[model samples]
Target: MRKWFIERAPDRDVLLKSRWLAPVASRLAPATIWQFNRRSIARGLALGLFVGFILPIGQIILAVLFAASIRANILIASAATLITNPLTFPPIYYAAYRTGTFLLDLVGGARAAQTIAAAQPTGIWTSLSATSLSTFVGLLVFATLSSILAFAAVHLAWRVSLIWRWRRRGGTDRAVTRPTIHQEPPSV
Candidate 1:
């Protein structure tokens, strides 16, 4: 699984050459940022999911920056932001707005929100203050929960994969190598 991805990912130089990535090329030089380890990939996925869920714009750019700062897998971070692409955007935003409305209503802010929305007409891309705020709150909640869930899922999957591979090779006992202690000296 790992090898398949490593084979398909763009080279460091290739990414550096792209105009969009050129400005931050200096920060991308660290080998650790591109590593395929469980921790890095998990962090990358979490970051991507968080940004993707929270922000309507600049998801990839933001994910890249976050991934670089956290030393996550950049490719994974970039790819994970696809969770909020065109096909999925409507449902996600609609759900987020509804969730925010419910939470606000539960906390006694629904009247104020409804009054504000009713007072003004909102465009497709832009909305009144109250509506936007509700959506933002909902997005924040979604982003936090989803990121946490994604991180845990990645780690769990990786653990399962490792156990499966070990079992396939032989058994759990064979997967571990205990350190050997020198009990006696051997004569040559």
Candidate 2:
């Protein structure tokens, strides 16, 4: 798992030489960003989801920047941004728009969406309306709630897994190792 995070994060050597990352280079150089711990992983995953959901583009860079500032796992944050890729983009946006519209209505200021069809349909980008404000609001709300939920979920799951592992190890705090296949020497 640590190796997985290491492979995703930017190398320390590369950070010192990159012009784009120069501003945050010194901060990211420390092993803190690469630490495979609970808080970092949780923060990284939550930060990545928040940035990815809130913005359609620049998710990876934004995740990295936020992770660096917040002391989250840089690589995990970067990888988590993939949650909002091409395949999942449209549906997620549409859902966010709907959520926003619903929330706005509940706020007692329902903005009636007027769709003046311009020789084309808006598809599922909205709730059958032309209201970008609602979508934006929904995105903001969605991002916040999602990130919070993700953070809690990660922490809870981490604790549960640890307990499960400890129990499986005969109620002891021992690292379980998988058995390796024994290879017999060939007769010369």
Candidate 3:
């Protein structure tokens, strides 16, 4: 899985040559931000998840900025931010709106809930209205929780993989190093 991910991920050269990223190339310290360590990868995933959930536009840039600020893996951050792509956007946003509305109704009362329900968000532009405070709150909650989960998951996976490899190697080494009978000469 790790090898597959590494093979499929965009290398530094590809990212550097990207026309969309050229403007910010100077600002990004590629080596520092692209290193693949537990902390960097976990943080990058978290940042990417957070930005991906909150903003529809400029997600890549936001992920890059967040990754750069925290010295996380830039490639992973950029890739992970694709969580909110076209196919997944509507459902995620709708769920967020519903979650927000529910929370607001619970906290504020029926009036606030009615207001959010009354404002029909036909498009992305209309969705950002101040009238729909529930949507914003819901997004914030979703983003925060998603980021935290992503970070923990990455960290846990890394640790589990390391342990699995270590245990497998220990068993394999014992079997390989075991003494064998010297009966080849008799057979010949």
Candidate 4:
């Protein structure tokens, strides 16, 4: 029964693995990320870090999907790490930590600060200070966001390019064969 289900249902690994994904992914049509030009895709991946940092949630999942769809190398997809490098890690995390703390405090009332510190004792004591928490959270958030965005952007560019190529080819064919309805009929 378990084997049957494994074969019938979309397993998590199967869904996650790009090669295995081809069959189901085919439904994505001409917009597939797999169809993208390699150099362009690589460049796009490199540039996506900027967008990733600004995006909300850990949207790097989208980046992975995009990379898979575009068939761009996973290395390029993971390159959003450029934004979270050693130099920037401290500042970004510090900002996120402060933002999260401030936001939490605003919602949790005047006692929010003391309560959070107390509740997540180890995290607070070891790493959640305004000075440290930002770095920690920044690292976490940057990793999460970049991965998601790179995948998404790569996939999006691939899909658009595929559709555009198809349309362009299709248009040229149509134009070449199109007949003029306004033309006079041939005489016998």
Candidate 5:
């Protein structure tokens, strides 16, 4: 096995020297961004699109984190979030509400039952119209929970895929191997 750490030029030495701050600097500092692997970028884009369509917030963050961990360009990952931009907010929110309602029924059936009964007189049409407090709260709760779930799914997906890829590439000699932290190079 061979590992090499390229020494940064003197003008950019401070950024390259601070072990703790180097990673952050790499992310936030401006530089001539480069693409690592086209295949990985394509896979990431597809994943980001699916996530944005189904799970916006969590998907956005997960995509960013995933790219960051792999030392991919953060700008591209950040752009992927546009998949769920303002244009699609309403529909996404609506779907999130329905999903949340389903989850609420499963986990807190009794509470949901009570809320439904108490808010029944508001009428089904009126309830989902965003006028009633219960409806609003339900929607909010559903979006939050769904977002959480989506994030969990993203995390699991990244871990599983990364592990599988590593093993397939013949990197599984150890039963357990900690993931590496990918950092960008300091700009000259």
Candidate 6:
């Protein structure tokens, strides 16, 4: 499954040579960031998830930098940030805003709730009014939770895959190695 997925993913060389990334090719060590491993992949995923939610633009650039700094897989980090792409961004941000508003209201009482309700945000880039504050706080919370969950999920999936492969091969190996009694055919 992993091999299949990797095969279908964008090639490291192709991405590096692309016009948009060619200028920064010197800074990107494809080998270091492209290799697949448990630690690197998990860290990359976490970094991607966190950055994806926090920054709507330049997510790939930020992910690559973060992955390189943390010795994680840059490709994975860049790809993982797609979680907040156009198709899913609205819902995620809305949920984050709602969550932030709820928490603020819970902690700050009706006055805070009323304040947040009064400010109608035209978009994500609006001023830091009550509504925006709650939205920001909620985004932070959601990013944190998503990062942690993504890391854990990757680790869990890796472990499970390893165990499954081991069990499968173990059974086959035993079957192949087990002695099979043979008797000469009765003399005819």
Ranking by lDDT: 1, 6, 3, 2, 4, 5
CA lDDT of 26 in candidate 3? 73
lDDT of 3: 0.81
Model 1: per-residue lDDT, tens digit, 21-135? 7788888878888999999999999999998998889999989988999999999999999999999998988888888888898897867766766677765533556677777
- Give the local distance difference test score of model 5: 0.52
Q: Tell me the spans in candidate 5 whose CA falls farther than 4 Å from its real position.
A: 1-24, 28-33, 36-39, 46-66, 108-188
* TM-score quality measure for candidate 6: 0.78
Best by lDDT: 1
When 5 and 6 are scored with TM-score, the better candidate is: 6
RMSD of 3: 6.7
Model 6 alpha-carbon drift over 4 Å, by segment: 17-19, 109-128, 175-188
List pairs with backbone clashes in candidate 5: none
> What total of clashing residue pairs does each candidate reach?
0, 0, 0, 25, 0, 0
Q: How far does residue 66 in candidate 4 sit from its true spot (Å)?
A: 17
Q: Which digits, one per residue and each the tens of the lDDT, describe model 4 over residues 1-188?
A: 22453355434444445775565555333333432354545544643463345444454555555555545533344455356556875577667766655654566632544656567756635343543444444545555566566657666876787799899989989987877889787789
What overall lDDT goes with each candidate model? 0.86, 0.80, 0.81, 0.53, 0.52, 0.82
Q: Per-residue lDDT for 96-174 in model 2, tens only?
A: 8888878878874454453343435657554344567777888899789889999999899989988888788764433
lDDT value for model 4: 0.53
lDDT of 6: 0.82
TM-score of 2: 0.73
Clash count, candidate 5: 0
Off by over 4 Å in 3: 17-22, 113-131, 173-188
Worst 10 residues of 3 by lDDT: 123-132
